[model samples]
Target: MNNPAPGASAPPPAPAARRTIDIVNASLKRRYAREARFRFMGAAAVFLGLLFVGVLFGDIVAKGYTAFAQTYIQVPVYFDSATLDPDGSRDPQVLANADYLGLVKASLRTLFPQVTGRAQQRALYALISAGAPQQLQTMVRQYPSVLGTTRDVWLIAGADVDMLVKGQIDRELPEADRRIKDSTLTLVDQLKTEGRIEQRFNTGFFTNGTSREPELAGIAGALAGTFYTLALTLLLSFPIGVGAALYLQEFAPKNRWTDLIEVNINNLAAVPSIVFGLLGLAVFINVFGVPRSTPLVGALVLALMTLPTIIIASRAALQSVPPSIREAALGVGASPLQTQFHHVLPLALPGIMTGAIIGMARALGESAPLLMIGMIAFIVDIPQGITDSATVLPVQIYLWADSPERGFVERTSAAILVLLGFMVVMNLAAVLLRRRFERRW
Candidate 1:
């Protein structure tokens, strides 16, 4: 209140501005703290997501890597000419139907003469694969000269013995709980010590077909079926989807009908995949009389399921082409068709292909749709053509996962690894193709 000495420095203005500055500084500090907490939470979230992905992949690899190798046992077989060719005719049919299993049993007896009781003998014989006879038949057919020789042939071990060799079976379990008894364990140990048991890279797992026996089961048939189904699905979906999208996006009248179609396509993309399966079952099978469980039927189903996705993606890709490009093309004396085909489509091709590949990848992993078409039937033969009854890889995995055998467990995981590899390859192809096409223009 004192006006004395007006030039006496205005009494320092009560330091009022300092209070406002302090309040602002405190608020800024709190804001900075909140920002740091938010950043920490985001980093933690990203790390948690990555950690979960790593654990899932690691577990799958741990369980599946063991299936790459198969166990085998060496059996000294006296290829009794009387057993292989009882009449010595060496006829193909005669050799085909011979009791090759008897020869395997006789060899097992020679290896372990101590096993006398029929039940004990059966348990000992259980060590070798049931495919041993078929193996012998194949070998004899390949080399007729080996028919009379006594040779030490390495044969696939039974699933149980393979499990025991791989340490999957617990030896400490009681006889009632264990799949194999102490007697079988002793025999397996003896074979192990004698250097007769061997583990080798399993080529058959990639080459053979479905089997009731786990040891003989492989992914070959499923791989073939998957290839055929996907090829046909691509053939059916790509052209049709692209044409439909081209018409609707570039040429079609903007009427209510086209709008309804656009809306329905968007909705179809959201439909459950199983509904497509039911449609295939009713339409492709019931109305058209297409054979069930064939790759042809599966392809039809997958093509239908993938159509909406392809249409949507294609339309988006077409729309992404700049309107200036179309204007320039038309201004340069190009027709509407010429502008779209010669300029717009080529530019949008990479996106279109990327979408197509994504749809195919989805089809590759689908089972419910194929299952509705009866692709779940246990077809043992490798399908040679599209019309042949077949089951794709996903269905094969489903079947194996449902199996009770411990051996099938590993095979199932291994099959999953294969499926994932295929998916990776497909996605990589899409990326590579996109880059390639992008550079073309």
Candidate 2:
């Protein structure tokens, strides 16, 4: 009825003209600018992070590459009756009683009979590992029948000789400044020409344990200890951590006490790892009387450290499961326990595994806690079980890093490489598992 609209109504204020710039600014311009800025910032941050990682990796590789190549000398030595025993009778006890240094000296003397100066011979013998004599004695004792025969043995040389063979030593350095003498280098060159000395991949490196001589050190013992400790940590921490998380998330009453417990768990996760070590020391070591420095103690400490992480992750995963799934199960007359276990738990598994693996990785690289628990000891033998005293990879690295030996620098870097490799593998496993088992519903 009010057809009085038209141009009536006071010449309706001339339709406000829309500004093209305003439309562009309000719709596309602002959004595009904000998105572009956000993207640029994210990309810049990622690039900077990657740059730092690349530099760090490069440094580690540069410093550690030499450790993979080791120098060895193959010496032919004659075990004379005089050295093995004055009487030609091969007594096992006599062989055991033989001096290792005398054997090494005899071997060197036989190799270079023409060079008879005692000091020169001592210098040559110095190239061999101090431990070499003990090893030879063991060999002779093991095979007393080979007492009077010539034996060919591969002996690890001193760190100086190792540095020389590895090309780390500067030939330009003065004899006084250099660890290895010019005479030793000359012998090494001669040995190389004779095919008695060469550089090769150090298989012993992975099998040997910490030694005073870097050239003789291996990570095998530490690696085994780490494996056992981590295995124990996983076995003990995972089920308990996940169980606690599930109960707290799905069954526990929502009350102040529960809230306080949750708060404490979160706080524990943020506690300094060394504090956990101290706790373990007091409880596991002192009160429980679990052997100090044993894998059991170390594993217990790591389990404590990893428990909070697992619990947090598991709770988050369980929380992420849609409530509708549980309701649906219950709607069909399923009990609460059945609904949670059969329907929700499966859905949360992938995230739980990812969290557990990440926690394990963190535990693997932890050194401070292990240090306090006495895992810093020079453990050469692989542990027989969790109760045996042990040292881990990180602690081994720490021990090597603090050594006065020059070759320890490379050993430390090599250990870092190994630790990084473990972390990478764990992360990859977590990613693969999550992708394979993650459920959308």
Candidate 3:
């Protein structure tokens, strides 16, 4: 290069410095723009996810809130001595043999004094649950002395009345086409005015067992059964799952046997839930002679289903623990078990619990396996023990949903809400546990 004249003064160093600054500034701007796009995409994904969840919650609440309200009819029935005790004395056998439907009919007549025709009485009679007669019979058997007295009784009405009171009935429909006649509506209004028919918080929803009639249906039995089954599952699966994970992660020799085990675990995770159910039926029910449809059987099946998930998640969590922590614990003369329990386990606990609970939530919603094990059958009484017959929420919902009656639709939706509530509680518990036990270091 030729030397420039002295006066040229080295073509000002400012231009080259400006070019370098421009290049760096452009590169930073481009990087910042890309970062902003990624952040916006992430925020948009979060918003969409929240929106979907909100819609689902709103729909469930709207459709299922009515299940919490129950309607009851209050009526006074006179127990005539002729039917209850012909001898006019308290005879337990005679009282037991008393006509309960007669009492119900008399009560209905008293409730609707405005109508006297036999056909209308018969029509009004259809508005009472079929089980009401048995209920009255039971009451009389329990209280034999009440035979010759008039007493006020609050009884569950039929599903039609329930639907009407809950606004599920279309009032504009013609009287001939409506399941509930106009006469019943007139009586309902009168009863409403007299405070004899009212809606109250339905303790029955949580206290009573399943029924064919929507008015008599309750999830208490199923709820209890689910609780027992899940409790047992957690008890059995957690220790075993975690212990296996620890051994595999910390001490097991890496060999073909280990590899085969790992592969089997991964394969088991992908197995259909119903397959596990069938296995449980074959092995636990048939081979071992465990009672079918019991909470114990259900819990065992669920534990098997959840094991793979727990193992995989736990191993991942254990592996995520920094090796340096283990080395330090060993440096301080800590046994491997002690180091794992004291240091590594605490760090991995949040992830482990998250996985376990998520797996449990999956188990709670599973109905296919439950169906195979006879959890689909009707359970009129609460289960007394793990060996007792029982059902779960999903099975209850399935049984109800399969009913041909229109009332079961709402019942199914209601059961779904209950199941969803359980799932939400489980997930919330997992989130809380994760936050409460999480270790950043």
On TM-score, the candidate that comes out on top is 1
Residues 1-441 of candidate 3: C-alpha lDDT, one tens digit per residue: 133334434454687765665566557657999999999999999999999989988887777788888777887878777876788767667766777888798788777777788888887886777767777777877887676788887777778888888898899999898887788888788878998887778777888899888778889889988988888899988999999999988889999999999999999999999999999999999999989999999999999999999999999999999999999999999999999999999999998998899889999999999888888879999997788899999898888888876667777788899898888899999999998998787
lDDT of 2 at 257: 96
For candidate 1, what is the lDDT?
0.92
TM-score against truth, every candidate? 0.94, 0.89, 0.85
Worst 10 residues of 1 by lDDT: 1-10
lDDT of 2 at 49: 100
TM-score quality measure for candidate 3:
0.85
Q: lDDT order of candidates, best first?
A: 1, 2, 3
Task: Please give, for residues 1-441, the per-residue lDDT of candidate 1 as tens digits.
Answer: 223233433445557754555556557667999999999999999999999989988988888888999999999988888778888888999888888898899999999999999889999999999989999989888887888899999999999999999889999888999999989999999999999999999999999998999899999999999999999999999999999999999999999999999999999998999999999999999999999999999999999999998999999999999899999999989999999999999999999999999999999999998889999999889999999999999999999999999999999999999999999999999999999998333
Q: Report, for all candidates in order, the number of backbone clashes.
A: 0, 1, 0
Candidate closest to the true structure, highest lDDT: 1
The Cα local distance difference test for each model comes to: 0.92, 0.86, 0.85
Q: Give the lDDT of residue 407 in candidate 2.
A: 92
